[model samples]
Target chain A: MPHRRSAFFISDRTGITAESLGNTLLTQFDTLEFKRETIPFVDTVEKAQEVAARIMNSADSDQHRPLVFSSIVNPEVRAAIKVDGALCIDFFEAFIGQIEGELVQRASLTVGRAHGMINEEKYDSRIEAVNFSLTHDDGVKLKDLDEADVILVGVSRSGKTPTCLYLALQYGIRAANYPLTPEDLDSPTLPKMLLPFRHKLFGLTIDPVRLHNIRTERRPDSKYASMDNCRFEVNEAESMFRQHGVAFISTTHKSIEEIATNILHKANLKRRF
Target chain B: MPHRRSAFFISDRTGITAESLGNTLLTQFDTLEFKRETIPFVDTVEKAQEVAARIMNSADSDQHRPLVFSSIVNPEVRAAIKVDGALCIDFFEAFIGQIEGELVQRASLTVGRAHGMINEEKYDSRIEAVNFSLTHDDGVKLKDLDEADVILVGVSRSGKTPTCLYLALQYGIRAANYPLTPEDLDSPTLPKMLLPFRHKLFGLTIDPVRLHNIRTERRPDSKYASMDNCRFEVNEAESMFRQHGVAFISTTHKSIEEIATNILHKANLKRRF
Candidate 1:
């Protein structure tokens, strides 16, 4: 049997950075099973010590050195978390010195600065983009279609809305999605409303089998969820994409992040970070 | 002035994991300036060689080693990316061997498994949670309120919507948010609509200064954007949180990720990863 290890992601703030980095590292080792936990907002020595005790308890039970991935910036808190029985990999401690040497400057060592409130303008822009996505979802509003960074077109369940939302929330991209209905997919040409903004159009297509399954889950036994309808919609969508010279991707085997990043790359869109 | 270095986030697939982990490490060294780029879909040796050339060019122009953070799983592709004149930190190559030894099993060496379509049920659940958040946003659908994992109550701009979306998209949480209005604030007890779900209620507060700035952007000179109104709303909202014994956090100095993670921790909600 494979050994089960306890992995802790600890940070002074959200612990997202710690978790993302740690999870990436752990994914490479697919043979082991891991029980992961995140301990965020550990900015004080008391909180750090409490976390240390938890780590010790887990290590004692597992009888293996628990892997601790920490991003605590406070020196005192970082020191407090360096308890025995755990193999601590402090991101700041491990790389800050090297980076400082490379840059020929001293780091401020501020707590929570990585994900803290630094710029209100940027935050407002993100919120505005999100509101834009919400308002323009599912072809609801097309008045300011030109303002969108990218306009996604797809069948009802081709993973357009989630991809648009992810792009807006994560990258501050003004994404709007329009669903390609059966009437719109009747012909092999682009829809009339999308012709003027063809340059901003990106298509998402899914496998007919996957689309049928997804649609069946939403509305069981409906004509819209039929295999024949899904197959026709996907085929017509692809032909339209090719005929109109619109770049399209199949979302059957991709995550939302993958689809969003691929769209950004293919469309040469810059992340607003 | 700090020396600027060229940093590349290279990966076999979406490059999100590489970019995220690299960004976190770079944030710790806040004193330096980094010219960042992401090269995704490097699954072949030819593509890896192409990325290697780009890295070498950047290193040559900057007169310093370009930092390459990679999660490429293909051995040939990984070898091609390990070109000289650049400092390569391969996440998969660094740890997979140790993990295989620990587990006593060879990994599958699959590409893009970290963020790929390994499970459709999880994807469907995320989409369902996102739809739930959208429908329940701003108390739009109060029916079946008990189905929510957490219900956030706060002023209009207290950072509720984005946090709910983030929780849903990232953690598969069925989060619903209700904006606290002046009518609700007039009473000392929890809102009648929220009384039945008090155990699932979490509040968000913000500094009046920041709240005024956020509201003023939307409604330029309205009474709702006035500083006095902002102060009254924030103060009353916080007092209501205390009177109702509802847990709350101030979003003045925190990011959306921070607020969402804190809410998950406080509510003791398990992330459906």
Candidate 2:
């Protein structure tokens, strides 16, 4: 049996950066089974010592030294986490020195600076974008269609809402989604409401099988969840997009991050963050 | 004047991991300014060369070596990006070898694996959480109050909605937020609907000045946005949280990421992602 090892992502702030980079690296090592834990806001030496003790305990239990991915900015706190039984990979320590050398400057070494409230205006805009996306979700509010950076048009279960939310939250992009209803799909021309905003329209289509499965979870045995309906909707949506020169992509087997990033790349929309 | 250098976050997939870690590191250098660009889907040698050329052009124009933070996994593609006249900091190259040595195993070296659709069930749950949060936002639907992992209670514009959305989107936590209205604030008791779910209740309070500023943006001079009303609502909300033995945090100077992470930490809620 493969030995199950513990991997820790530790940071003085949210630990999001450590988790993200560490998880991505871990994905490359598919043979290893790791039980991951993220310890965030470990800014104090006491907290760092406690984390080190936890790592030691895990190492003893697993009979292997645990891997510690850290992004702590403070040298003293970071030193406290470098327990003897752990392979502490300090991300900040590894790169900050090189960055400082290249830039010919010193690091501020501030805790909670990465995900803190650094820019009030930018934070407010992000919140505003979220509100905008929520208010205009699923073709609910067409009054402020002109204000949207991009309007996603897709079938009911083609993954529009989540993508819009990700775009708004991550990039502060004012994304509004319009669900392509059966009535709209049946018509050859684009929905009349979307005519003026053709340039802003981006379609999302999904594999019929995936769409059927997704819809079945929401409403079992309903016509909306039928395979035939899903196929028809996706086909019609793609056709509409092609006819109107509106770029689109398949959401099947894609994460919301991929979908949102793809849309931003294709649309040439600048990320606010 | 500080030399304004260009920073590129290059990746095989969405480039989010590169951008996230790179941005966090860059924030430490307070004196230097960076014009950042993320070039995603650089999975091929051609794409990598194009990005490298862009970096070179930026370096030539600025008369400063650009910083390239890359997470590309393909060896040839990654090589193409390490062009002259730019400081390429390959994130994967920096740590992957050490991690491989520690694991005593070879890496899969897969492209697009980081943000790809690796787990369908996890992805679906995240979307479901987003839907649940949206349906239950601002006390819209109280029927499924029992289903929430955490219920955030705060005065209007106290940063509840964005935090809930962030928790749902990032951690797959079924977060629901309730607004403490004027009527509820006037009373000393907690809302009747929230009494049964008291253990799952988390309160968010903002500084009265910040709350007033946020509310004023929404409703310019209304009684709801007044400084006195903001103070009364915040005081009442915090009191209710204290009186009910509920854990709470001040969102006056916190990003949504911080607020969500802090809540998850306090509630001990397991992150689905």
Using TM-score as the measure, which candidate wins? 2
Q: For candidate 1, write residues B1-273 as lDDT tens digits.
A: 357899999988888767866776677677677999999899999999889999989988898888888887789999998977877777667666665565556767777665453567778888888999999999999998999999999999999998889999999999999999988888788888898999999999999999998999899898999999999999999999998899999988777777888899999997777
Cα lDDT over the full model 2:
0.90
DockQ of each: 0.52, 0.73
Docking class of 2: medium
Question: What is candidate 1's lDDT per residue for A1-273, written digit by digit as tens?
Answer: 448889999998888777876776677567677889999889999999999999999988998778888887678999998977877877667666665665556777776566554666667777888999999999999988999999999999899888988998888999999999999998887878887899999999999999999999889999999999999999999998998889999888877788898999999887787
Which CAPRI quality tier does the interface of model 1 achieve? Answer: medium
Worst 10 residues of 2 chain B by lDDT: B111-120
lDDT of 2 by residue, A1-273 (tens): 567899999999898889989998999887778999999999999999999999999999999889999998899999999988888898889899999989988888877676464567778989999999999999999988999999999999788999999999999999999998899989879999999999899999988999999999999999999988888888898998998899999888788889999999999987776
Write candidate 2's Cα lDDT for B151-170 as tens digits.
Answer: 99999888888888899889
Worst 10 residues of 2 chain A by lDDT: A111-120
